[model samples]
Target: MAKRGSRRAAAETQRRRQTSGRRGQERTGWRLWLRRAVLWGGALALLGALFLGLAVAFAARSLPSYGALKATQPGQTIVVRARDGTAIVELGPSPGKWLDSEQIPEVMKDAMISVEDRRYFSHPGVDPIGLARAVYVWVTGERRLQATSTITQQLARNLFLNSNRSLDRKLREGILALALEAKFSKQQILELYLNKVYFGGGAYGIDSASRKFFSHDATELSTAEAAIIAGLVKAPSRFSPTADVDAAVDRANVVLGLMREQGRISASEAAVDPSAVKLKKDVSQNSVRYFTDWALPQLEILLPETFEPIEVWTTLDVGMQQAAATAIKGNVPRGAQGALVSLDRDGAVLAMVGGTDYVATNYNRATDALRQPGSAWKLFVFLAALEAGYTPEDRVKDVPVTIDGWSPRNSGGSYAGEIDVRTAFAYSKNTVAAQLGNEVGFGTVASMARRFGITTPISTYPAMVLGSSETRVIDMTRAFAAVSAGGNSVEPYGIVKVTTTAGDVLYQHEGRNPTRLVPDYVAAGMTDLLQTAVSTGTGRAGQISRPVAGKTGTTSSNKDGWFLGFSSGITTGVWMGRDDAKAVPGLQGGTAPARAFAAYMRYAVKDRPVEEFQTDLQLPEWQLEPDDEYYYGGDPDEYYYVDESGNLVEPQRPGPGQSPQDPFPADGEQPPAYPAPRQPQYPDESGQAASDDFLDRATGARPSPAPVPAPSPRTRTLTPPPQPQQTAAPRPF
Candidate 1:
């Protein structure tokens, strides 16, 4: 009986324990369900906040409802102008939609609807049915169709949501769609969508895309063209004219099928093979890489010290920019690089190209390159000689010659024998310039170059006459420009105006903007001399129909080639070479680069009337005896020789202006002439000695004698190009 009673009690205890355990398990299950509910609620809240933020950003652009009622927003079209105030290209407002529904065609409506969202007309900005379908496919199939965002949602994404694909982000995207629906109408959303979508090719909107792809207006699209534009909406890069055409055709055909299905076009119309659409565009947008890169720095300086996204009012002309870039690229020899810059009379940057193919690299060789100017430095040589006594018509022997033990010669070894100053300058004959430098004093040449704005650290080396010193293209360009402007040197500025986006005029360039570096007559004479170059000289290829004047230079082994010229309308500069300073074999500045300059200016200044260079009003007869080289510029040493007494023994006293004589003794000694020949550049070492005879009687100016007796015909002197900047910033615009 006791055993039976114990079993019953144990059984009862076991039954009670089992029942309590089941109740505890049920409570834990309920707790888990409650925690999950809280988590999902928090996630939903976070999604809502994210969407709210996106909605606010989109609204900042404009209220959709307000935009729907208006035709267009103010200041939407940005026009790029030439330095002369001619419109080169217009930017903004593409897709046949002028920021308004009134300008949109019915076909455009269908094209956009077929491409972006078929149900856009039926819903508020968010399409719940579409999202539901997307979710169903995602869950039930291996291939997940992307989220079907409505046009409003896409705009919301474009203006606010960055490219993030997290699940939380999708949920937030959904919420933003709802907000956008309440804020904007379908029409307004469509307008914004058409105007803001990227169309690749560096184009920002439909208008730019229209000009780029078809070279036509967005309003003039055929059914085929419309289909093509519609296809690009999905991904501009994939269907752009510059991209793979087969892929673009396939995409366009898909868009056509959608158009047919939407009843926007007939099946027959859709039957037109998209594969047959001409995809190749002959037009090219010359991306002036150097100009844009240079513009960035100028924009920085033009803006306030603070950071605000302000539009930079620049002087770059789109057409001219295209022309200049095309000029450089089309003419640059293979394996070589070139850069070009166009300037207006006021020294405003008109159009600029830093490299031939801007997309290929970013080396701004135009303004940043520091190359020896080669023979272009002859301009300054003439300026110094003319100031001393030499005239353009004066005769100078172009035979082999040296100065102070260094020799210089023309590129071709053969000489014109004896040529007038004009022919010698035009031909870039080395010996004549070297002789001229010696006769006038290397100091005079160097000093004149500095005054003309040459900022490069200068030494009075005999080789400067051959452009042996380093100079940036900017200074080289400006040096030539000063000659065009009659000696008044002005700084080149890309920014014409600085203003807040609200149109507050912060800076305006006014006044003469003058820096009197070279005498007016000196500059005028130099320009006159340069005209000979463009008309029939080495720069003949640069001749525009208008009055054009310029120079061409080729460094040793064609390492550097240069063309700097001017017309009544613009002054331009171009340089070509290798980035690594490697030799560009057999290239001449006159052949390819100068032709490029002429070609560009034709299109760039088509609208402006060609103007001729003005006369030098300041100093007449600046070159003195405008006839011959005899009495006016005879060497003083021709009649006088060094005497035993150590007198200069020259006919005239040394000009107070001459270079300080080397203190070392004259016979068999070292002197301070630049570029003491490591390798002699003369054609015949013995022959150049004969040409030095004319300088013997030495009546010109001389300082005390130094080591290294009178220069042999081999030694040459150089004149640096004008410097770029020398003072505070001048107001541009």
Candidate 2:
């Protein structure tokens, strides 16, 4: 029994020993695995740190120097002021005064923080939580959550980076934001952002925005006004009070809601009435920027290039500019644009409204767009005739005449057999104008146009007499100003004086000596015709309280409408049309354009002394004499030649060796003698036609008429003496 017990005990001890050895091996294997894991983790952490350092260093290289960030000077500023000394616009970087931290209103700061960055104060330049949320939203397409950009990041982007949507730019922006946070206090960064953000309408910074929208200093901004300013940071022009007050107020309400939610303002404080926010009276009349834009280039040319700030006193009349803008916007049709330019007798631009809304389009139509002037171009035609010693009472036959097979008919397809030049001009009779152009010679007409300051190309085609040539509003206004100045030349100028901010004069406009473009008697004769036009004819819609003279123009299919007129030394031109030159049914210069002119003139001339145009002129009487050689002589009433179809015919001239009796002229001379009288084209119900009105004759669809054979050597003696050359003076505008 003792021997068996000893043997069992020894087996039990062996089993125990084996089990203990297995447990020890298992623990050693676990220790070895743990040591390998620790080594791998350390190597991965070091690699991650190195990568982060390299990325940060590369982004920092593109950042602006620290000194540049601290500098407060905005390179060169140009402050344009109206003649009355009110600041009209500012050009260049950081135009307005920068406000310090204490100068910024607490309300402005809170409103900006609530809307732009709710966690602006809590984040350390970069918010990992926000970044994760942004990534999740991007990956999951969760549109409800917008990507957030903290204020510090926004400041970094504005100061140091271009607006690019690349990953590299984002990295640089983040790194720069962090550097800025390390360098400046939170208050300093906030102040810099407030002073650097754009708020539309040539306004930069909080102070400028406050002054522009409220006509008050930033320190006096109401909570509602502060909200409006803050809302502009996302889209400045879209929410500008001057651009769309209702939209701006709506955005401000959104900002107010954000502020209340963030506990920045009380519910009652957030309930401020939008109506209580009264924008500056002139805030909506920012159309004056068009004039300032035009004048700035001229000012730059007048002075040497330098970094010093300048103040330009321009000739703009604020009241007149407002009146002109109101008239154009109130009268122009929807989907159409209107432009107006007013010049004093000396050609100082007083008011210029380029379009109905400057924010919608900045294209200066008055100075840039070239459009067909229609019958407004007849001013040059009559001026040419007057210079040729023809009086307003001279008679011309208003008949359908074809030049080079191109027929130009009256607006209504009816003709007045015989009419005086005054009546022809007043009625805008196309037939009479065409006949007169044939007699006066297109070369002489072109020269007359240039003398009156038309710098655009003028085609001497026969159709040009009926206002087919394209011209500019400013150029046309200057031409009319010459007549208002009693035949003196006019140069349109906007800048009166340019000076440094410290009051040192850089340039000043002294009046130039007037050069006579036409004789006083000729101007008086033209004035009589224009006055009659406004008082009794197509331009009657342009008549104001006092005596005024102007002409109306409407191109075919109503593509363009124009009214160029003058009153009390102020010559204003209004043009209404589409940029695409599409037809507008029922549109005419005698309607909308004329009404706009009258509306603007009532205000423009209210403060000026009444001035009547000189109508009486001592001139030789003009008598119309029929050419017996070309006409079948009969009663004076029957002197007009007509075709078998009863269409009035143009006299056939002798061509080459053929006599006037030849049925056909030379190869391309005079279109087969009026092939079919060109079935007088009339506008359809929609006022659109397939014919190209302005360049129909010039188009190669029909053969061009050969030039008139040089005056026969035998008849040279009958020609009158050539007129003396007119002087070429620099245009004043």
Candidate 3:
């Protein structure tokens, strides 16, 4: 019994010791875990505090400086317009502040507040309500409405930020907003924002933007239009009329709704103008500046020292030019660009606007584009036929023909089985012109075009017959002018006479000898057909109080539209097409451009004197070249005989042993005939010397011929009595 009690006591003691040991270990582990948690928690608190302090410091230190309020200067440009005054687009004295609360149209101010900042006057640099709304969008990952922007914040972004949006950028924007407020007054900030913001295309600032977007002055804007400008501030590219039209309309509608909401405008007032107003077109380098662009490059040569600021006086009538610009802009529809070139009989460009706006783009549709003449080119084809002895009474078959794998179809899927050549030309019939081109030989036509000063490369394909060869507006107008000049190819001189700013004549465009390109009778016949085109055919829209000749073109697929015509002393061509090379929905040459040509003619010739085509008068003698079409074993004498000067009158003398009826080229080369021996490259000593500077710049070629005998002395007199004595002495001998 004693031994059992001892073992039990020992076991109990061991259990007590083990339990105490486990309790001690458990307490130690719990204490160590608490210490670790405390250390980590303290470190996190210190890091967060440091981050907060840094963010605050960064925000305070990064505030905008006064220097940033200044707009950065880029290259300045001076635009010299045709007939129109110069349009200066550049930083001028920074204009102090572009927007004056007093000067700003009330509608523009209301539009801004209604579209961009509803509570602008009541808010700080940053709008709490706007920030909260933006946060909600950020949190939900939803797209924000485009019309929500604080004016101050927008100025901050425009002045400092790139176009990308992100969390970092947003934070920076908020900081910049505060900085901008500290640097500028609310009015100053608002004004800067207005002037610095871009409104679609490349228009910068409110003043320029006003002129560019509306075609009227900023002060001329109606309430609705003012709101439209204000709406563009939220998203200039989106609300720009030219860039994103639908988005622009939608944004504009949003602004209208907001204006109504703010009680700044009545519902009726807001409804007066849709977000997208009917817009007038812009004048561009291609169109209105037609002569400017061509002359600018040469101006430097003419006025080497002071050319930087010379005012070019042009023949452009501002009102007529404006009408043409407006008509082309509105006529091309959505998919195409339009161009027009109007000239006087002297080849003075009256109205030339290349594109809708030069500010929106530099692509001059007038001077830069090269398009197939389509049926407009048919005039050249028929003219070639007329030169080849085919009369207007000649019959031409309008049948399907494949020449070198090229086939031309009559427009609108209709064909006149047999038609008079004159009627075919007047109507712009495709098949007949094509057949005529083939019959005359493409080379002959090409050579004739060259003589007419057409520099664009002409192709030999059958499409060339139907006006498929690409040509420029300037070239087209000039080539047609050759016909207007009565069968003579006149050099297209842009400058009549260049003078120094001081009025000293530097260079003059003397009336050079007109190159007789065709027989006067042949040209007269072609001119008669063209006259018919104006009165009763495709060019009827362009008819004026006087006789007219014109042609219409609708390219395959309606990709291009053209209206080209000639009056007594003027030739004009209007082209419509897309910058992207896409076809417009329903535009055709005979529609808008034809109407525009007609409208322009209404005023362009209003005050000008009346004149008739050269065809009505008697002409000089001319010789007919052998018809190229007959070279392939056909009759060579099929053509009519015309004198070398393109005169339709009979020759003074017939060739030896030939009937007076034979009117082919007089046997061989006659003196003074073209292909006449060119003057020797070098001049005789008696010729005048070129200026040393000019001589130095000239390359290996010799200088142009020197001035002939100095103008005859003013004091020189003649004696008639001396002439009789010389004849008497000769009789005595």
The residue-level lDDT of candidate 1 at 490 comes to 58
- lDDT (10s digit) by residue, model 1, range 1-733: 9999999999999999999999999998999999999999999999977877666666544544554534433223434444565544444433333435666556766877898889998886778798788888889895666677788777767665766877777666666666666666677677777776667655544555666677766666667777777788778766765556676778878888999988989988888876665654533333644665676566445555633324446778777777787888899888988888777778788887777655345567777778777777777888876655444555666665545566565564566665677787787777677777776667777877787668887667777677777777777787777778777885777767655557676655553658876666557667767888778788888877888888887777677888888887578888888888788776777878788888887887688886876643333321222221223233324355545553544455457787633323345343113322222234344333222333342423433232222211122222211111122110000
Clashing pairs in 2: 491-732, 491-733, 492-732, 492-733
Candidate 1's C-alpha runs over 4 A off are: 1-286, 306-309, 610-733
When 2 and 3 are scored with lDDT, the better candidate is 2
Q: How close is candidate 1 to the true structure, as a TM-score?
A: 0.52
Mark the regions of model 2 whose C-alpha exceeds 4 Å error after superposition.
1-68, 75-79, 88-285, 618-733
Candidate 3 at 194: error in angstroms? 19
Predicted model with the maximum lDDT: 2
Greater-lDDT candidate between 1 and 2 = 2
Please list the C-alpha lDDT of all candidates, in the order they appear.
0.66, 0.77, 0.62
lDDT of 3 by residue, 181-234 (tens): 655677777667666766654566666677776776676778767766777865
For candidate 1, give the lDDT.
0.66
* Candidate 3 structure lDDT: 0.62
Supply candidate 2's per-residue lDDT for 705. Answer: 30
TM-score of each: 0.52, 0.58, 0.51
Tens digits of per-residue lDDT for model 2 on 21-131? 999999999998999899999889999778766656655565556456646553468888998999988776644566788988899999999998888888878777788
